[model samples]
Target: MSDTRPTPIRPRPRNDARVVTEAAELGTVLGIWAHPDDEAFLSAGLMAAARDAGNRVVCVTATLGEHGTDDPRHWPPERLAAVRGHEVAASLAALGVSEHHILGITDGTCAEQPPDGVVRRLARIVSDVAPDTIVTFGPDGFTGHEDHQTVSRWATAARATAAPRARLLYATTTAEFAGWWEPTRHTFPVFLTDELPLRTPRSALAVELSLDDARLDRKMVALRAQATQITGLIAALGEERAREWWSSETFVAAEYAESRSSWATWQVAA
Candidate 1:
């Protein structure tokens, strides 16, 4: 039998915001990402929202994102892994996540085929934690990075073996509106979900969290706390200004769900 699964077709966002409300409190959620700041950039708000709604959220990062820093002053290869690991721990805490696990794969590269031992280890963790939902990079890896792709692939496989009842969600890009696309470069921004434009046949479920300016400010504060990653950008744009730029986050559900239609409770609009 083929490992690939079918994708679902979902509805476009309604002009009416009332059609969607806050998602029901999920029992437990596991977010698997390739790097330190991936959670903050892509799903911090969702994590915050979930936590506020009383869900247990945990993170599994595949790599330290050691290759991502531009400042050679702080990130020599020898110390990058350790530094980024600490940063991941700190960042997840800021997001209200109490539990975190790092697979400790190589910073720039991951195993072409993750070892059966690695899979078993991840499976054991998942079985113990037993999250109701698993979120990770889509098949395109958001920008088709090999490491991100590898983690997503492994997360999917791990979901099957570890917790078959868990809902698996591959985080994907949504239609670009606002200044989301790289206007100057005429491409997707590097190292973020803002760049991918391809559409998959997968059923997509949308989740939107509405926040007031005060809450948004708090979110941005948490974002800026990860100094190793976005410090320069935060300095240039100022904290609140940068938050305004990417305040509203969007994600699409791909594979792992029986029907996209059932995800409507997770959707909320402005």
Candidate 2:
């Protein structure tokens, strides 16, 4: 018998605010990301919303963000890692998330880590936490950052090995947002030209969370908690634009199938 399984079609992006509400019903939720501020930048609203609804929200960061600072006179690389570690914890706390884990991988060097080792560590974390929902960067890394891409791969691998049934989502932006935001270079010093335009097709997006004022307030607090990295962002975007950008969050659902090997191969749900 020739293998014949119908390929799953990608779902069109809809205003699925209900998904966020449903996620709160899930017992455990995990947000995995590359560096200290990633959770704040991408998923703080969702994290805060989920936590407020009484779900156990956990965040896992892959690196200490040692290379994040442009000013060595103030933050040397060795000390920057520890500083960022504390910052991320504070960020999560601001979102009402009390559980967090750091993989201790070197900042700016995630792509250099042994793939299997990285996957294994993440798998262990997933197994221990057993989240019902897992969120991470899409392939674009939201900014084309190598660490973002590497962590995305690792998170997918870990999900397959440790929590195949978990609902997997990739943080993303709509093409409309990309076109409007990319050309204006609204993300300047924080996100450079080469790093951006990481938007996904609207047709592929799965969820959109329209944050309420309270959730937006928490998100702002979380972002401010990462002061070392976001000072430039606040200065550049100004308070109004920054609030506009942070008012909503979006994600694309990812689908995966078990391969001939023990692992799973992931693709956009389209």
Prediction RMSDs, each to the true structure: 7.9, 6.9
* lDDT of all predictions: 0.63, 0.75
lDDT by residue for model 2 (1-270), tens: 545332433554355434444446555889899889999988898888788888888889988888776577688878888788888888999888989888888877787789998898889889998899899986556665778877888999999999999988888776566665765574363343433554455555556778888788888889998988887777877888788877878787766211121112222110
Worst 10 residues of 2 by lDDT: 261-270
lDDT of 2 at 233: 75
Q: Per-residue alpha-carbon lDDT of model 1 for 228-248, expressed as tens digits? A: 777777776566556765665
What shift in Å separates residue 230 of candidate 2 from its native position after superposition? Answer: 0.9
Best by lDDT: 2
Worst 10 residues of 1 by lDDT: 261-270
Alpha-carbon lDDT of model 1: 0.63
Query: Which residue pairs in model 2 clash with each other?
Result: 10-269, 10-270
**TM-score for each model:** 0.76, 0.83
Judge candidate 2 at residue 102 and give its lDDT.
Answer: 88
